[model samples]
Target: MARSQKQKSVTPTPPSQLDRFDEANSARLGLICVQERIPEDYTRWDIEFLVDDRPSRLTCISPGEYGGVPHGLDGDFATILNVMYLEQGAPESGIVHTTAYQMLQRAGFPDSGQYYQSLQESLDRLKAATYTASESWRDHKRQRWTTVKFNIIERITAETQDGLGFGSGTTLKIQLARPVVESIREKYLKPLDMSFVLSLKRSLTRSLYRVLDAHRYQPSMTAEAAAEFRINLQQWARECKLRETVPARIKRNLESAHKELVERGYLTSVEYEGSRADTVIIYTFGDLPATTPAPEPVIEVVPDAPVTDALRRYGVAPTVARNLVSEFGESLVTQRLEKFEAMLKSGYQARKKSALLVDIIRDQGGKYADPEGYQVEPQRSEANLQAATVAKRMEAEEAQLNHRLQEEFRLLDHSEQAARALTQVRMFVGREVSERTLKTLLSAMTSEQVEPYEVYRAVTRAASELRLADFAHELRYAYGD
Candidate 1:
């Protein structure tokens, strides 16, 4: 979905995107908080995340034209968002200038060809990816859990140099989604050092740190209403939002992050729950939470009084003046106004400055189409029948899977048979069943081993698929279209 071409200089961006903000504490806790690794040959990852004690579920979709998980530079995008916040304050929308090299350095990424490629990859993922959450809590209150699904990066502007690569003054214009703006305004987010999150390699330690950091609303495990909880291996995996990796591997990676964080002083200690030998819980959050917070961003301020005076003297409307501040920033606006003064001194009519200035500002910045305006059309190959057929077939398959699992449900011990049955049903079903459907089934199951469900649905997906496929074949044979 990401498109790129060489440009000599950045086109000025429109002001509609000034309000975008980074994923601060308010936004962070609600996310999956872990990388959904791109499988070896696959470009897409269908991931469902649930924190053990949290009531909501976040299903992350890193969908691209060519499917794949987001790269390390995806982490860098968060830093870029914060940079926008710092540069413009709480702007509604506008462009900021800098090269890819500066962004990599700012995010603690190595400056190199590999990283540059990754930067491009990450931007593609961010632009195309979207997440759906059910009653997901945002803000410090954690009480306003509601449904939301949107991209973190609304739009990006990267210019490629002719013989060189990405160079200086490449304007990155971004628009933060509505929910993000509200969270940024409410100050519901915790601040993390971009360097710290980028420091850890892709593994459980990385995810572990995020999970712990997400809990800084209660810096101490003993703090009231903190998200601290007891969990064995399975629950820990779910809570930390790790992908479907082996339990032993997830535990070891967590232990690795544990040791690293403890040595770095982010954790006072990471220990097993004394009463429950298998349970792991955080006992402390080090001085990380108390670090200096970023200064509030000023939204579209006229930083220069002299420029304001000049605009007022020229008879420009106050609202237009404010919008000019937003579009060009105080410094740039001041510069533009000074240019107007120079034009007047050189003999242009004073009365014409405002109209001329307005026209000039509008013409230079390339108009930006709404970022969310694009969507991928659903595929319709022969195998890809209508969604209704797919659903009907799936229902029939699940019905059969249940009936068969129930026949053998009595053989297993009582840890939980339902979970295993659901898992088995997935095995019997084809991959065509959307990940969203699988996520729903997973949410209903407990942390115990997958079991046969307590009961099977009466309708059968196998019969339905057979009937639909046969009907389609018969029609095709009769009308050779």
Candidate 2:
């Protein structure tokens, strides 16, 4: 029979069969080879195949080819075809050709007319002739491998783009059950060492109480005993080489802890039944260790002579004088006595002078009588008596002139004070004043002025009347006007 046109176009192609067999066999073999080498865990694998002297397991597949392979033919079609084969597969034969073209287009490969179409057509033809072998055995063998591969790929993509990886670079996401986070913080995050020390300190008080209750020691702990305990604790801290001071925060904590334990009825007082010296020793230790020696008592002695003198001079009671003598030494007592004597002597002299002056004035007429005494004369006639009186009056006037001259020198001191006040006011206020104001202010001051209180008052009043009180007050009080 002659060759039919249909037979020519679709021949019984043996080469196509051989090509399909070879491709399927190769794919199956590749899977088996890689399965043994690849790790089951995602963490162990690399994204790309490892390079070696042997043929590489991975084959690159272009989006323009191998698009028609059945899903069952590979565990992951894109990975198997695109990453395994170089897009060189059998020729197109049926509807698989059109499907392959669509897959390539979906994969973002350009549809550049005939060249891409021809490649898809070849891949489709290969798929048609390829035996549809059962993938069940391979799937069973490489199920773990396939999972690892998928995970690895996912991790690699996340790591390169999102910074997820192993070691310090790895990011962890934690999800705590409700209330667990707070519980964990409360149980663990508190200062454990401080708590431990506090507990130990509390236990120490209990131990001490047991000793006291058993009558193992002496009387109730005294202030000295407490001080000793503090000192010992400080020494312990020092010996331990602690960074903090013993008298500081640590000691405070210990004291608080001890007090708390005592309040909680963990300690009891023990009575001392011994001699006076032994009793003193017993109370000194309390429940603390009796290691440090007691400090010696300090006694001060004072003499009685100076104290007695001070009492008489200052009008202090005898009992008070004795107490002061006992409390302070003789030197301080003597110094105070001398000061009191000096003050009393000065006061007495002032009073005596005043009394004498008062007596002299009283003898004259109970007032400050004129220095000259009045005189009367019985002369030959009234004219003669009058002349004698006039002569006496002239002598009195001359005596009065001498007294006035002596008093004038005393007034000079006050005049200087008034002058200083005027100068101060002028310098501070810096205002021009009339001569009348100056004279009026000076006239009010004492003739023998020591301090310028009157002068200051006069100037202050004049400033107020002048309507410059604010400025003048500032000058007087603040600027020394």
Q: Against the true structure, what is each candidate's TM-score?
A: 0.48, 0.12
lDDT of 2 by residue, 102-218 (tens): 333322233344424443333332333222112211122122111111110111111111232222111112122111121121211111111111132222332232222212211
Q: Tell me how far the alpha carbon of residue 441 in candidate 2 is from the true structure, in angstroms, after superposition.
A: 99
Q: Pick the candidate with the highest TM-score.
A: 1
Model 2's C-alpha root-mean-square deviation from the true structure amounts to: 53.2
In TM-score terms, candidate 1 sits at 0.48
Model 1 per-residue lDDT tens digits across residues 1-481:
1112222122211111223234453334434334435454434333344434556665566654634544433644654665545444343342343455556555545546766766666666766767666655453335445677776667776655433344322224455555665555444444444445545544344455556554543421122223233446545565454554565566565676677666665566665653333655544655434343333323332123344556766777645766776666555555455455555566665457678766545545633221233322334322342457646755765565445446545554443344333333333341334445544544444443333343122112433455434433432343223
